[model samples]
Target chain A: MSRAWAVSVAMMVAALPAWAQDVGVVSTEQFESPRSGGIIVRVGGYKPLLDDEKALNGKTPFKDTFGDSSLLLVELELQRYFYQGIGTAGVGVSAGYGEKYAAAKLESGVDAAEQTALKVVPLGLNLFYKFDYAAFEWGIPLVPYGKLGLIYSPWWVTKGTDDEVVDGIPAKGGKWGWGATGGVSFLLDVLQPRFARDFDSGLGINHSYLFAEYTYSDVDNFGKPGFVLSSRRWMFGLALDY
Target chain B: MRLTFAVLLLFASTALGQTAPVVNFAVPGASQGTEIVVSKATCGDTRTVTWSRTGTLPCSSLVFWLSSDSNCSGDPGDGDLVLDSEEVPQNNTTTLSGTLELKMSDALAATPNLSCDTQATNKSYRVCASTKKQDSLLACDDTASGVGTPTIVFTLDPVAPLAPAVPTVTGLDSALSVSVTVPGDTSQMKVQVVELVQSGDDGGTPTAGAEKVSKVQTTDNTVFRMEGLENGKLYGVFAYAIDKAGNQSDPSTLATGEPIPSNGFYAAYREAGGQETGGCGAGGGGLALGAVVAALGFWMMSRRKLS
Candidate 1:
């Protein structure tokens, strides 16, 4: 009777794999969604290198007035993947805004009643490459990307309600430059594979990721001796592929 | 045939028995139940009172008058002031029209018995009109029947509102910000700025210079910014509350501020020998770049759809 009970237990153990399979517990590699383009929403700290000019003679006017604080820059970038085989390559366009406000300084070096503000609108066009192949095939869930871009930043200074004018020149202009960015994204689908598949089927979103990037930009009109709007900053944001 | 003749005879008697004409009074450019503001600025302005009659009753004239009573019911020998007597000529037309021009000063002068010295107070009067038949005014005794009379209230506010509190002045670069606590009865506030000329002698008080700038705020906002001032100079600031009648109150206690030079970011950049001139850099280049990017995106989207 003990030998018969051992046989019954052995048969039940043999059918366990088949039972799990029948109950829809399948691997994520089976279901795949078509991939196209991606959208990224990012924010970063940006402070233009205004004191780097040689004529300033070691005087940090920007730091003296606004102090050593970085403005919070929020950016939105859109990329369309034209080639998407081993990796994805696309041209992206991004726009961002940042501003800093501080109490204006008087001629006596004291704080004034009115506020002075420095505002910037940064626009960029870039060609990007994302090595997302391992994420889809090997399920490594980490995608590394690189971007080379051209940037044009329009900046303005305001005192009170009007544009600040000094020596008959209005304080508003744009600077042109170039930048390079490198970032790594972590796939969110690996944490919740079933919900990720449902999201794909329901909202047409193929994948989602959280990413952080570092950018090195030289935005002084190709170093033509002007206001150096260049900066090196790190940005963190979410990325969505559809 | 006898019944038809009797009906015609009754209609003819009813038409002939109508002795008084129906009158309606309207003030041009003024809506119903709105108070008209009379001030020193508009003292000589005239408001036309139009009356229209709709009856062929052979009325001699239309008598128009102003009375403090809402019904215009008091005896004419008392406070009732006759404005105009427009003669109605005998004509074939059933509708008769007349206009009475009421000058604001004349209206105020006619009602001397009423108080006009209070701040923002309404002095009301009824614009009454009656059709005259052989020098006898019709419907003048019937106060209960409110048919042809329209009441118009005149806000004769000749007194100024209470002065505001002393202004709190802040010095800025080539400007001064002044704020005051407005009185409850104030409708508007005015801020006046004057530059102060300091005496060359030591410890002498600064004398007031010519008025530099004045700004009137018509909103409930009590803050004013006097701009275009010279830097490194002292200035006096004063605030006054104004009533709805355009009467300005006495100036508040004197407050002073000193404008100073303020350095902004652009100024700092220029001081650092930045070569970039402040303007649109490379005109139209930014716009062209945006257009190219947008076109490329649309083309890529269409290609995806085709595939």
Candidate 2:
């Protein structure tokens, strides 16, 4: 019986190597989906420089009504990459909405029973470049980007329920200008590479990132003198590449 | 075993025959226990009551009555009013059904002693129904072998709610904002705006014109905006509250305001010689730009698929 037990142990030990080979437990190769475009959802504080118009001189009508607080702007941007060799180059379009409301004031300097609101819809078309080669090839997880864009902002002011009209001039207009933005994005795939590979294979999502950016915009109808919609703000949000 | 089965069958038959008839009542088209609110607006309406019964007891009639008592017990007292009687065919039917109409005017006339002036102290009555033998008259009494009586209540309300406080009026460009502090029991408020016509005589008070510009009603106590008035024109504002019973209160104290030209941010910019023509043209330009970008994105997506 002891001889039979020795033979059985030897046979089990010999099958272990074949079982390990079948499992194939150690592999670092990744199969990724094709990448073409990305979408970003961002929110930030935006305060238009309405009082900075040279035509306004010293009167701050926007400040007097809406105070110094900034409006919360929510924006969504869609990008399509045209080149993706060493770095990625793309054209992006963004749309955003922001509004501010306060109690309207009479000429007597007292708060009225009605509210006055300023609403704006900001639109943008941008050419952007992102340096993401290090994140993909060198195992680094940070991507830096830059954007130069044209901005068109439509603004309106309302007192009570109707648009304000002062001396036959209605309180609504649009401004056009240009802007430049710079941002840094942190890649989220490095923390769980296996899960990232699964995500790419199953959902066709190649990468995900959390990013923060600063924009310097001048949107006063290309300096023709109307409602100065220029603004400098910072935004933070998520980005998904598919 | 056969003898035991026969005894059990006889006992079950006796119990079924002795059971009281189960009676249920409802307002026709309404749920089982929905209360009928009788206000001045609905005082002339007729509400039909439907009753159904189920039992082995031999019943020949179904009678419905109204009582101020919650339990709907006892014979017809001074406070108890018999509504109507529905006669069923005396064929020993186990199930019976009928309907009776209760006129709100008659119910109100029945209570000449109680004041139905206000909803705060409103009067309520319960509807009851019972199945009885051919000659029996009283319903909802101890001697009746009927059970499962209805508990639907009818309330009478007639008076208007208290007037709201005086309104505070503010003037804007072509608009008037009216704010009223609503009373506790009020369910809604209405704001009325009228253009004030100035008198030609010197130092004469302006009179409100006959034509009203706007009449707005809201359930919330927030400020009401009356729009579409001429700028630089004086206007009169009035507010009133209404209760849930559809009764309107008296008009509040008059408040006056003048719609003047106010400068907003864009208006100020234009007044300062900022040359931006605002309207649908500028918005259309933005939309055109967005369409171009979207078209480019779709083209790129299709190109990638082709490759």
Candidate 3:
């Protein structure tokens, strides 16, 4: 009996908010991150580029990114939220897959280009500010997104190391790649589907969403996928707003 | 870790036991040498029969009734060749026999073979059995002339079994044969060989007859002789048996056998145990034994400087 009462009290406390309803915008023009009150699967791709410093594009293939040879990137991220668009930003961590161009030479802090498959697994923390729509008809309900984070990408298996040579990769598994992003999201409000009832809450209901965001990482000249072997990811994501 | 160990112990306890044969030899009331026997042995579902070898060679072969009856199989004579014989003055040898034999892989290895041989024969070596005898690491003694390249050495002294003062010779059923019969428990006694010597009519003794040409094997408790030698000449005969431990018993009382002399040969060569141990009968033993002392070294250090 005590356990049941304790659970009820805990749930009530969790529902409390630090702030009230929406005052930001009519429609959420923010990137509705993959994060939601409930978990949803997401998979997609993006073309990455350099943005940090001139070094991000120096020995990296970033300059050639606008062309057809930019890069093919794949990514996946999972997240869950607590409140309805007004709580701690549950930054979703993701691992990205892509292709990079390369040459047999150029071994340095950046030049060691690997023209092979490249993959990066990063643990990240995204701080997105959630905003709810005005409790009226046909208004917006989405997360006003803005993310500034860092990912520790260890080029542990970066090519050329297996060719039986001293990779001068002096620093083996290393530091993080700093990144910043922002975007908009569109939600799907009312779909009945099957076996489930659509909430007919007299007010505006939450819906499925679509979003695209721009990113920039300091993966300048890691491999041969391009000059900027590691870069920003332009992604399209689908999410649900509760 | 405890759970893992417990699981392993449980599995091990379930496996059945596999044991071999043990040998313990005895030659009762031995005046000179003792005997040995593999009293208790286990041939469980295996065709393993036990046999003993002489000298320091860990070359005893086990015989089994069927190939599946024993842990080891193949040529009975193909015992492990011992090398690097070492001699540690071991004066005691306690034999265990009954149901199962213990693992002796390390018990009597090449080093022990060498050491024991040295203490027993004053020599160390890697001994190998050959057609003639066995080869050893220790080269032969210079005075050991006429001694072939390979030599055979028994584990005990009194090379010959004790002699019976009033030994009897009977069971003779052939023209040139007679048997050496034991008085008491003949189970442990047997006839091995028949040595024949010829003496001239003169008061002087002559080194008798012809060369001793015997059969490949002398069966258990059975001895045979080829008589019908040059007649009119006196020939002496003796027979004996060897216990499991390679200890030979005393020969029966010498009797007379007169063979019709053919050609100039009037005598027959004596058949006896073939162990030609030099002075003190200590055979020369330690030979080639390599000792490897491998020492691997690794060093790691750490330094911290606060600036």
Candidate 4:
């Protein structure tokens, strides 16, 4: 009668939704699974490196020239793992909107200030390589990953220098351009819970991850001379994988 | 004895019919240093001359005259009879005192057949009244007003029209539709269109000559149909507004476009945001694509164990 009671309780628990991973003892196999495929969504912020001394507004920082700016980034990606924990290749599309740069006077003694904006919407095809140091019993729970990708981003400068004109047209905004990007992200798998033995064997699902990544992008100016749209920033966000 | 001498002098002045009347005289609408349009619709413009007696002495005859010369010394003859009390009742000192519409033909009647060059040329007028005969007592000529003399100046334009807006050129079959903003009223001004040519020299300094493509007489139409343009050759267009005074305003900004047929590929090229930028070279596109493909292939090969 005790054995039957134990069997019934186990069946009831297995039927429950896997809202969280079990917190059982972690093994190296979790990082090396070969059939993992899922989606990740993240929201973060970035700072523009507009203070390159070679730029037109070199003497002034981006925030000082355009007054109080914030760059907000939102990304959605689909990851297809060929080697699961060993390699994860994905395509991600990200949109970033920089807040209106503060009003600035194009001409001296003019009361009306010119307001400008910057935006970056990039579609990236990236390959991620995750190191499996845990498989060698390194005891380190942090998984380090490297990303390399080609970024096709449509960028814009709503208000540009007053004197800049291309072929009688304002040289402010244009079509999508090409760029290359590379970054490194440290995956914090240490915080993940290991489920009890009853839920150990199943399709992997319902995961929450915390990560921090630093990226550098080198973008072309379409045809604008003496103008560079390259930017670098560190991002921190939460990614839900399923 | 001194009182008797004064009485005799006054009697002699009255007996000789030279008793000059104290009359206040002016040419209405005639202001010192003010310009007047003389040859707009007719040979000369028109105005009125007014006169009044300052004292109780009734002046029998008052005359208004103009002289091409500033000095009123010579009798400018019958042509100078702008008005006379004997004819026009407005010349009378009592009844609103004489007022007559004065034109260049009537005022400068001495030179009745003379053609006036009404281009801001300064002249003069005079008003004289006598209590008796032709001996005038009160007279105000251009010189009588000192440096602020009421001179007769003729002009063609009081003000010039503003310049037209920059033109936009679009290619059509065998011609171009040049669009621009209508400056103002069509009746007051005419449009001047010029074709700009560049020699393609190293300097590339554009020179505009008497190469008039077309003249748009109507101000109501903003689009000028420009023809005789060479296909695929770039042309710069400019516009100007000529006022009634023959004052041509500065030309509008240059609008450069190449003419094309309806079926031409380059016809829509200019409208396709082609200005100020060339496409990424073929080499650039190929290199970027190649790099992406190469990186993806190498990455996939390194992880072939799972595949």
Candidate 5:
């Protein structure tokens, strides 16, 4: 055949949809993958917004104490998607932990070498609706999602001497109460195709996402009536969806 | 009556003008003079003086004396009289008289004995003799012999203090504890502690160029503590005593001490790699931002679903 015929044949092969092509190591799959039902584990850093907690953190070393303020946070979630009736919507349950610590050595006092820390754990269920336009043949790969959830977060003071108060809250026992959360996730696999590549056979991750979330947890004081142990925080983390 | 008057007058002149009796003092066989180390503290080791008459006149009694003043001009009246031996002169063929022993330690005793007082170290002492006789009326004689003569002069020298015993290391770790025995010879002295730098080859011996760590200001304190020392390093320690006069005693035997290992405090709190958990609690600003983003996401989702 002539060289012109060869070019035409190649063009035909490239034009065909991924499903009608032969199976190989590299397939012509675009953003046609499913958008829900996966396990996600994420770890990030967070800063609390409670006035008392903020005051205590501000006093951490060099601010009035001897050491700096730092907090560690982690989360794990399991989600399921229902695509038949409500477009692409998902429900997920997550458990997470956040700890903020500030240790200081008083220049002079009875409690010269005192350390204080606050730990909070949030466990909740949330509902999310994804805007995946590719399913309607719009040829868009982006999937932006919004979510709202209710959490019963338990918070306690980890390290402090008896009778010491951290940000107006008694740094002793823990309290569990109700709270709320709201956030949005942006699928990065649509922007970076490499994040969706399947390295192994069988069930594999199909998308990578980044999310920013806001949380407000209220752990009312078991003793003080007017005193409330409510706090707010901002968090950003990465998640993988299969 | 006139002859009797002349004889009484002669007797009165002899009694009134009786010349001072001559008294002699000597340390038998001690021609080079008496030498004594105050540290010996033994009375028998002291040099004793023998006295005899050197003039024609005879004294009824003789008294030996020791004084710190070189002149020895004052009798027992001068508080400088450190010792005295009062006795009748002995009758001998060589005109020998009484003997007096000088115990230097007695001069330095905490409680001095009568007739012999404690003598200060590093000083000169003179020995003399005085004679006393009763007058015709049996009253004490006013004129005494050897009032201005010092027969022998002895020097009091301090014995070198005993060196402190090799120190024993007690508490080791960042601080070194060493015990030094105050020299028995002196009670008012300062103890000096020296620390030797490790040459990386300190074979348990003090380095030639050792640096002084501290000086215990009080001799009463035998224990010394050296602080701010490097942990887990070898150091040689030695001590000496310094008297108020700046006399230094021999140094103690060298003692080697090594500090204990310290705990890794900073290492445990260093940065560690991995994901950190604990979500940030959202504030009003964070909530506002989240709501705006959520609204955009919801509107986009609704538009696509309707299409």
Candidate 6:
């Protein structure tokens, strides 16, 4: 309909663009239909800077006053595609688990620090789309494309180390947020000797990709949504399509 | 006779050229305040003396004192030597070393318990001589009236407490049990745990989710929690042990664990603290070190400790 509307649609696809662009294969093997769909999964994590977590609120039961804890992230994306031959879109859903943690503070049990840990999870649904430009005619042998997705990360609840206290602080979980993401995707074939001739003859194809995205979340520290949490990152992953 | 003469000479030198005793104090941080340790507590061989006009205040310029109590107390011995009423000589740091051995008839006539050894709270005391007896006024900050009565510092018997050997972290997530064995003389020791994480090696561009392992102490073992880990993501765990007499050892080696890392921590805690009963399902794992690091070994079995 419109350029903005189109971009919004592209961001709703759930395929790991990096994977598809990096290792996946194209459907040059005479497909039954001009469409494709598959699954994408990733397990990874990151650490937040001291400055960022301090922004969460007052104090926490975490043993570390400094920024030392780390986060583990696991995600699942179910992707389905249509309209192939360089031009197509994919739709998918995702889910996963993760946590944050720190070690004990003091040596003695009396004034010692406790090893605090936090977990993050995406408890919501997702949708997305992508537009791939054919790699045939142009000198550019790699296929290039763009993507957009809408992620509804539901309220994340925490568990374990419940009775732990850091300077009289208890634990707290967070609310859900609507995340919007958009980025680029590419396809690169693996240099397997057996597939070389077939790959050059256009008989076989592989998928690989790189994508950058921005995610915004909501914060209800003061009992109301007053802050928006945001994270931006570039990821590399692969997905197969036929 | 010559040998006796030589021994005498050595003794005389030792007596005449004594070294100034070192004053040691503990600054527990600005929030904690300073703990002063006076040296050579006994006064020199003088009976009575006056404070010099020239010693700089370590913290502030204001100074005050009681004829008796060297302690920072508002109360002191009943001695109205009347401030500058009697100006003792200066250049007499030696004469000023101990308590002013002056008799106080007027002091006893007034406040009976006016000892110079009284101690006060949060106040610094110093002795100074001025032309006017009243000129020997106490100064608390720039305000002369704020100095509640006078205060002093007195020497106390030194009782040194021996330090205990350090302890170590014994376990992670799932009842981290920590065992600490100190010498018979060791006093109260404390223990704690904290989780940390760092990037793996970059030399070979290692894959994400790789873990970094730290040290642990375990003759037998010392454990803290059982299965209290962050899921999926890697972790760095640590511990510490301290003795009762305030002897603290450095933190112990760091262990690693991932609790339900597939799911996040806050989410799980919320579920646990709220709806789900110990929803931190038993699917977590730990990176155990060795038997020595009892705390480190628990990394393998991360079953839910809550439920």
Docking class of predicted structure 1: acceptable
| lDDT for each candidate structure | 0.75, 0.73, 0.33, 0.47, 0.51, 0.36
TM-score of each: 0.67, 0.70, 0.28, 0.34, 0.33, 0.34
lDDT of 4 by residue, B1-307 (tens): 9999999889777656433345455555554224334333343566555555443333233334453443434343453443443232323445435554656545444555543543343234443333332324333332221111334343334344577778777654445667777575223323333456566878586655455476655556766777776766666777777653355667777766665533111112223322323333333453464356446545543443331
Which residue ranges in model 3 land beyond 4 Å of their true spot? Answer: A1-68, A82-91, A99-117, A134-144, A156-172, A191-207, A216-230, A240-242, B1-307
Predicted model with the maximum TM-score: 2
Model 5: per-residue Cα lDDT over A1-242, one tens digit each: 69999999888888776646545455426433544464566666544333233223332222222123435678776666666343467776676787664543222222312244556665556677666555234545445566666554545544333233333434333333455556666666556555455421223566666777676666443222221345566667776655
Cα lDDT of model 6 by residue, A61-157, tens digit: 2323324444556665655554455556655555656655544333232222344454455533335555555433342434444444333222222
Supply the DockQ value of model 4. Answer: 0.02
Indicate whether candidate 1 or candidate 2 has the larger lDDT: 1
Q: Which scores better on TM-score, 3 or 5?
A: 5
Model 1 segments beyond 4 Å from truth? A1-35, A137-141, A188-205, B1-112, B115-159, B195-209, B218-221, B272-287, B290-307
User: Residue B39: error of model 5 in Å?
Assistant: 45
| TM-score between model 4 and native | 0.34
Supply the TM-score of chain A against the true chain A for every candidate structure: 0.87, 0.86, 0.51, 0.59, 0.60, 0.55
Tell me the TM-score of model 5. Answer: 0.33
Q: Give the per-residue lDDT of model 4 (tens digit) for A44-144.
A: 56554444425333343354444444477776555555554343445433333443343333223122223345555545566666553452246454556
Q: Arrange candidates by lDDT, descending.
A: 1, 2, 5, 4, 6, 3
Q: Residues A74-152, candidate 2, lDDT per residue (tens digit)? A: 9988888889989899988888999998876655666765677889888889999999999988889999999999888
User: Tens digits of per-residue lDDT for model 6 on B242-273?
Assistant: 33223345544444444332212332222223
List the TM-score for candidate 2's chain B.
0.64
CAPRI tier of model 2: acceptable
DockQ, candidate no. 2: 0.31
- Clash pairs for candidate 2: none
Ranking by DockQ: 1, 2, 6, 4, 5, 3
Judged by DockQ cut-offs, the docking class of candidate 3 is incorrect
lDDT of 1: 0.75
